[model samples]
Structures are given as structure tokens and as C-alpha cells.
Target: MAEKKAYPLRIGADVLEAMQRWADDDLRSLNAQIEYVLRAQLRQAGRLRPPVPTPAVEEKE
Candidate 1:
């Protein structure tokens, strides 16, 4: 498994509350919600790299 990287993030209370609400509504963890938002913004800004394909899983009896 890849090692996880961590960063310290600072946000205004209002913005944090809004993100918390959105995360809850979407059934996503707060970290995931933040990542999703950041990824979308980066994509829109043309700063995103090409996506790598994930391996497919097979079902067994």
C-alpha cells in the first residue's frame, strides 16, 4: 500500500460548517469531501493529471 501524506489545513468556521453539511448530505467523510472538492477545482483549472485506470474485480461462485 502507498504511504498516506498528511497536511495541516485551515478554514474559516463558516466554510468548514458548510463543507460539513455538504459532506453529510453526500454521505462522504469530511476528508473525502474536501478531496473531491479540491480535485474538481484542480480539474477545472486544467491542473489535473490524466487518470490512471483501476483494476477490475471478478466475482466467484
Candidate 2:
């Protein structure tokens, strides 16, 4: 996992309340919901790279 940085954000009260409701509906924390929304937008805009898949390990019998 990568280290995370904390920054203060200024959001309108109505927007924050709406986001809180959305986060609850999605069973995510407010911060995580915000990140998810931003990541989705970045992906849509071709600004973020797609995640690479890991190779599956073989099981020895």
C-alpha cells in the first residue's frame, strides 16, 4: 500500500451532506467515497492508468 497524504478541503455544507449520504448508501467512509468519485472521473478522462492484474500462484499438491 502507498502512503497517504492529508490535506484540508473546503466544501460547501450542502455538498458535504450529500456526499455523506452517498457514502452511507455505498457503505464507504466519506473520504473513501470522495476518492472513488475522483478516481472514476480521472479514469473517464484518461488521466489515470488502469490497475494491473497480478498473476495467480500455482498450488502444489
Q: Write the per-residue lDDT of candidate 2 for residues 1-61, one digit (tens) a residue.
A: 4588998999999999999999999999999999999989999999998888888999999
Candidate 1 lDDT for residue 11: 96
Best by lDDT: 2
**lDDT score at residue 31, model 1, on the 0-100 scale:** 93
Tens digit per residue, CA lDDT, model 1, 1-61:
3466999999999999999999999999999899999989998999997587889998998
Cα error, residue 36 of model 2, in Å, equals 0.5
Task: Give model 2 RMSD, 1 decimal.
Answer: 1.0
Q: Estimate the TM-score of every prediction.
A: 0.79, 0.89
Candidate 2, 28: how far from true, in Å? Answer: 0.5
CA-lDDT, candidates in order: 0.91, 0.94
Best model per TM-score: 2
